[model samples]
Target: MLAAGSGAVPPVVWVPVVAWCVAWQASLQHEVIHGHPTPSVSFNRWIAGPPLALWLSYDRYRATHLQHHVDERLTDPLDDPESFYVTERDWQAAGPVGRLVLWSLNTLVGRLVLGPPWTVVRFALSEARAVWRGDPTRRRDWIRHGVATALVAIVIDLGFGVPLWLYALAVVWPATSLMLLRSFAEHRLAADPAHRSAIVESSGPLAWLFLSNNLHALHHERPGLPWFVLPKIYRANRETVLERNGGYRLSGYAEVARRWLVTPRDHPRHPGRAS
Candidate 1:
C-alpha cells in the first residue's frame, strides 16, 4: 500500500496504511534500542538506524535512554539528559521568549504542536556548535546522522519523486504524533526516583501501540525485560511496584488528557532545581 502510494504501483485504497508503516518502523527502533530482535548489537543498530524519526540517531538515543534507566535519579534535572523540564538555572539563562517557549513546551498540546520544530532546530544548532568545538565523538555521530538523512532524502526524491516537504508531512508528522503519545504521561519529577514514573493503567489499543511502555515503572525497575514480557511482569508485581511508587496512577491516556489537557503537569521550574 505504501509502495503504491510512493508511485511504485498505483495509489492504494488505504490512506493510513503509510502512517501505520511509519509508526511500526518507529516501534521497531524502540525495540532495537532495548537490544531486541537479536543479540548482535551492530545488527540491531543497522536494522534500526533509518532516519524515520528524523533528527534523532539510534546510537545517541540508545546511549541516552539507557542512562535514563538510572533509577536513582530518573527525572533529576541535572542527571537525566532526556528531561524536558528546565532547571531554574536554565530558565534564568533563557530570555523572555525562550522562557515562554519552554513553559509552552511543558504541556502536551504545546509539545506536540511545537516539539518537532524546537527539537530539530535546537539539536542541529547544538551539533554545529559541538563540531566547531572539535568534539570528535559528536562530530562522528552527526556525520553518521547526516549520511542517513541524505539517504532518506535520496530515497524519497528518487523512489517516490515526492518533495521533501510533502515527504515530511506524510511520514515525519504522524510518526511524531505516535512518539508524543508514548512519552506523554510517562514521567513526573517527583521527590523519590521510584515515584518519578507514572502508570497509565487500562490502556486498551495504545498498550500494544506503545510496546507496553504504558507500564513504565516496570520498565524502569527491570530495563532488561523484553517488551513482550512487560505485561506479565507488570501483572505479577503490580502491588509491589505501585507500593514502591506511592500509588501514583492514572486510569489511562483518556484520564490523563482529561486531567492535564488544559493544565500543566509540572512547572518550568525543575523539581530538584535549587536557588
Candidate 2:
C-alpha cells in the first residue's frame, strides 16, 4: 500500500508489483481451499479470508471450487459453478450483442481483458437474487465476508491511506485477470471426464503465480496434493498424466494466446443437452 500511495512511488513499477501481490494472495487462497500446509479448514480460511479481489467471498469460493472437483461434471455449465459454458436456454434468450460478447470471451485475450468484470457482475447479480429469495446461507456468507473485509478496509483505507480506486484498478483487476489467464482453457466439453481438463506445461514465475496449477489436469486428478508437490507428481508420471487427459496440452500461456487469442475455443452453449 505504501508503494502505491507514497508520493515518491512510481506507478509504472509499483502498480504491477501490487497486482502481483494480489495475484499471489489469490493463489494462496486456492492453496488454503485445497488443505495446504495445515489441515484445519477454519485456520486456513482465517489465514486467507481477506477479500483482496473485492468481488468474491472465501466461503463461496471454497464451497463452489470443491464442487468443481467433481470430475464427472467438469464442464457441465449448470452443474459446475466454475464452468463458463451457458445453458441452451440462456444462449437462446441472449440477443445478438450478448452472443457476440460471449463468443469473444471464449478467446484467450478476450478472457483476460473482459472476463474479470463479467464474472464479478454475474456473481453479484446471482448473489443479489439469492438474497432477495431469502437464502440464509447467502446472507450468512455475505455477513461473514463483510466482517472480514472490514479488517481489510481498515488496513488499506485507514491504515495505509490508499484510495479504493487505486487498489481496485491496480490490484483487484489485474489479479483477477491473471487468474483468468490460468482458467481461460482449463477445461472444455468432452465425453471422457479425464479429458475435460487441459494441461499447460509451464514453470518459473508464471507457474508460481498460479501455484503450479497450470498443470491443471494433474491438479484435478489429485486435488489433495499441495501446489509445491504438483511438479514432482507430474514428473513422476508425465506420460500417464498426459494420456489420461487425452492429450489436451499446451506449451504455455504463449501457446494458449497463439492458438486462441482471437479464435473462440468453443461455442458458448452447452452441446447435446436441453437448457
**Model number with the top TM-score:** 2
lDDT of each: 0.73, 0.87
Q: Write the per-residue lDDT of candidate 1 for residues 181-271, one digit (tens) a residue.
A: 6676788867788898877785576787777878888778776677788888878888898998777777888887776666677787785
lDDT of 2 by residue, 1-275 (tens): 66556656777877788788788888899999899858898888778857877777988888788999999998788778888889888898888999988998999878888898998898788788988999999899999888877788778887777877787877788889998898998998899999999999988689989999999999999989999999999989999999999999988988889989999999988895568
Clashing pairs in 2: none
**Which portions of model 1 show Cα errors greater than 4 Å?**
1-16
Error of 1 at 10 (Å): 11
Model 1 error, position 210 (Å): 1.5
**Candidate 2 Cα RMSD after full superposition onto the native fold (Å):** 1.3
Q: What lDDT, from 0 to 1, does candidate 1 have?
A: 0.73
RMSD of each: 2.7, 1.3
Task: Determine the backbone clash count of candidate 2.
Answer: 0
Error of 2 at 156 (Å): 1.9
